[model samples]
Target: MKLSQSQSFVRFWAASTTSYFGTYITSLSLQVLIVANLQGGAADVGWMNASRWLPYVVLGLVAGVMIDRAQRKYVLVLTDLGRGILMALIGLTDLFGTLQMGWLMVMMMGFGILSIFHDAAYQSFVPQLVPKDMLTRANARLEQSAAVAESSGPALAGGLVAWVGAPFTVLVNAAAYGMSGAWMASIQHASKVEAPAGSVRTQVKEGLRWVYRHPYLRSLALNTHAWFFFHSMTGAVLVTFALVELGFNESKVGFALAAAGIGAVAGSFLSTMVGQRLGVGLAMTFSRILYVPALFLIAVAPSVDSFHSPVFPMFVVMSGQFLYGFAMGVEGPLEMGYRQTVTPLSLQGRMNATMRSINRSMIVIGAPLGGLIADTFGFRTSLTLAVAGLAFCAIWFWLSPMRHAKLDENQIEGV
Candidate 1:
């Protein structure tokens, strides 16, 4: 059946798309708020990034186990509501002139905690909405809409921030999350999984063993962990570099980021074709390699002072971000589809959480380190390290069993 024919998936898609827009808006605006409004720098960005993911490190395994035992739909709605409230509170604190770095970090941690449940449930819930064979297409459709949102969200956010200040801009995400929750509440069709019969600690250990023991998953998880760590470091410093070093304002930065969205849209459109032609593993490997050049452009980008027109540097950086986003858009659906298709329904939540907990734990570690490195060594230096790290991931994928990995009916049947 076509995805459009599935009402449940339609609602899920709508909810996800709405949240994506809000997420992008808040992501950019919050960075601006920290740097421009709060007078925070790289270290502060690192702290904020780290705080948000810290819960994933601490509570991730438990949340995954709980999600496996509970209703994923309810989990999604509740977390969305919780996140909405937190976003609103953040906006209110800034409005009241009481928002400090400490307060912001605390709020981010709350967001992260909810995210632990929300994200794990979100990934695990998707297979219930569509056929295993259709997972790639389903994910592609979701990414297409998300790419569109990414393309436009930042530009819209830039205008919102300029008009209403960054704090008020975040209120937009709160409203979006509320709507997402309501839409999710409307999804009535979901396949239920039997709760695993074990203690939470035992279940968590089982989840860990499942991921670490699977050959393809082990490599994928390790490679992804490394990639996220380095990518996050770049993220921690990029906005600061743009605003401070490149001399770009929120508007210009938004436009540059929008290029990523545009590239993502294109990538999403092409993902299925590419995946079919190259096969899943090769497609993923190709996308992984693209990050090397994409980040290299950013690392070597000439500062504004080096160019007579600030537009020149912005153009180069935008080109890089475009490629960066394209690579992500292409690989995301394939990776998620492969993971979901291979794993048993019973282990979905645990598998996702196990990989994500460690993956994001890297963010908790890398974000701060990136910030510190950027602060001490410089943005370019930190970015150079990130580029090298991404290059390493590409090489690993090329040489590892992942390059030959493919989906098989046998594998999907709990092999």
Candidate 2:
């Protein structure tokens, strides 16, 4: 069946899309709040960002076990509600003038904890909602929503922050999460996976063993871990570089970042076609190779001091961001579908969690490391390092087992 005609899929899509919109808004607004309102610096931003991903590293294995043993839909709804309340409380603290950097870090940490479960359950739940054949299309549709959110959320947040304030902007995010929970609750389907009889540690070990034993998955996991590490390093200092070195106001920064979203939307539209034409493995390889040059373009963009007007440099940055986002868009669905197809239903949550944990663990290291590099050396130097690291990742993927595997072959047999 076409994804558009599936009612449960539609409901899931709506809830996910709504949450993504709010999440993107919070991503920018929170940073702006820290840097502009609270007098925090690059190091502070890095720590806060690291706090958000820390749960994935800390609780990922346990969460995977729990998710596999429970009803995923309830996990989804409850986590969304929990996140909504947390965000609301944070906004209230800001309203009463009691907000502090330490408090913000704590709340972001809470958000990350809930996010770990929500993300693992949500990824595992998708296969239950759609036919295996339609996984690519379904993933593409979901990514399109994300692309839309990414495209508009930052620009909206920039304007909102400029008009009202950063604290108040978070209230909108809270509302979105609340509504997302309600939408998820309205879905008629319930996850039907029977809880496997095993200790949590045993289940976790099985998941890890499966991934480590599979050559294709193992290579993909390693490549992605490096990819996220280098990417996070660049991202950790990107806002600081724009605001300080490029001399950009919040609105211009938002506009510059929005270019990526636009490119993502276009890539989402083309992903399925590209996958069909080039084969998923080759498509992923090419897109990742292209990402290296895009990062180079951003790293080499002229700073504000290099020119009287910042427009030219900003354009260069935006162009690079656009390409980066586009590559992610094209690769996201293909990669996700391949993983989903290969994994058994019983191990879905654990597989996703293990992979996601490895990917996010990089943020814990990269965020602060990036911030420290930028603080000690400079943004350009840090970015140059990121470029080199990402180039190595691309080369690694090119030489791995995944580069020669065909996505259409029998799932594990191809590996």
Best candidate, lDDT: 1
Runs with alpha carbons beyond 4 Å of true place in candidate 2:
411-415
How high is the lDDT of residue 142 in model 1?
90
Clashes of 2: 0
How do the residues 1-415 of candidate 1 rate in per-residue lDDT, one tens digit apiece?
Answer: 7899999999999999999999999989999999988999998999999999999989999988998998999999999999999999999998899999999999999999999999999999999999999999999999998899989998889888888889889999999999999999999875668999989999999999888888788889989999999989998998888888787878888887888899899998899898888888899999999999998998888878888677889889989989998998999888999999888889999999999999999999999999999999998999999999999999999998788777766544544
Give the whole-model CA lDDT for all candidates, comma-separated.
0.91, 0.89
Range of the 10 consecutive residues with the lowest summed lDDT in candidate 2: 405-414
* C-alpha RMSD of each candidate structure in angstroms: 1.2, 1.2
> Candidate 2 residues 296-366, lDDT tens each?
98888887778988889988998988998899899998889888988888999999999998888899899
